[model samples]
Target: MTRTIRLRFFASVREAVGIAQEELALPDEVRTVGQVRSLLVARGGVWADALAEGRALRMAYNQQMTGADTPVGEGGEVAFFPPVTGG
Candidate 1:
């Protein structure tokens, strides 16, 4: 089954991806947030670099912080951003 997800990019991630938000439909194999990242990375170029493995990117599903292994579902909203830092 396909899952329709709303993707949100923030801060530097937004700058790198060059979009604030968009809707994506995932293939059944793309079940986890990390898989979604992989799909995007497969696009190559900036996407591959910005969300590449080992990068210090943060993820959120439905406004709550999430990990790579978290399962994604229908109508879910996922966000990606760099780790927050405060002085």
Candidate 2:
């Protein structure tokens, strides 16, 4: 079954995606945060470049810091952003 999830982009990720937030319907195979990112990376272009593997990026699930292995349920929220630095 397909599930709907909210995506939030911040910092460079927001700039690359050109949007702050969006809702997407995910396929059954896309049940994890990593899979969700893979789906976006499959889009190619800036998406692949921005969220590419080996890049230092951070992910959060439902406002809590987590890894890509985290399960994403229906109506869940996932956020992507670069590592923050304090000046």
Candidate 3:
């Protein structure tokens, strides 16, 4: 069976998309966090721009900050958020 990954969106992204999270089937070719974002982009326009490569994005895997190449095991949780600015 294919592995599934959970993606959580936060802050503006969540509000814009109107969803906090989603479960996605991991494609064999999408091996990195960046790739995963690109995959979501292909879903359509909103997804594409929201997950655009050049945008300011922060990522976590299993609740920890992770790089694009971080390996995601089965049923892992990946989160995306805009850069936090606070005092």
Candidate 1 lDDT over residue span 2-75, tens digit each: 67999999999999989999999999899999999999999999999999999999999999999999999999
Full candidate order by lDDT, most accurate first: 1, 2, 3
- Compared with the true structure, what per-residue lDDT tens digits does model 2 show for residues 1-87? 789999999999999989999999998889899999999999999999999978999999999999989999999999999999999
TM-score of each: 0.97, 0.96, 0.91
Score candidate 1 by TM-score against the native. 0.97
> On residues 1-87, what C-alpha lDDT tens digit does candidate 3 reach at each position?
588999999998888677999999997887778778778879877787787888898989999998888877788998989999999
lDDT assessment of candidate 2: 0.95
Number of colliding residue pairs in each model? 0, 0, 0
Residue pairs in clash, model 3: none
Candidate 2: worst 10 consecutive residues by lDDT? 27-36
Model 2 residue 41 CA deviation in Å: 0.4
* Number of residue pairs clashing in candidate 1, backbone atoms closer than 3 angstroms, sequence gap of 3 or more or interchain: 0
Candidate 1: where is the Cα deviation over 4 Å? Answer: none
Screening candidate 1 with a backbone cut-off below 3 angstroms (N, C-alpha, C), the clashing residue pairs are: none
Least lDDT summed over 10 consecutive residues: which range in candidate 3? Answer: 29-38
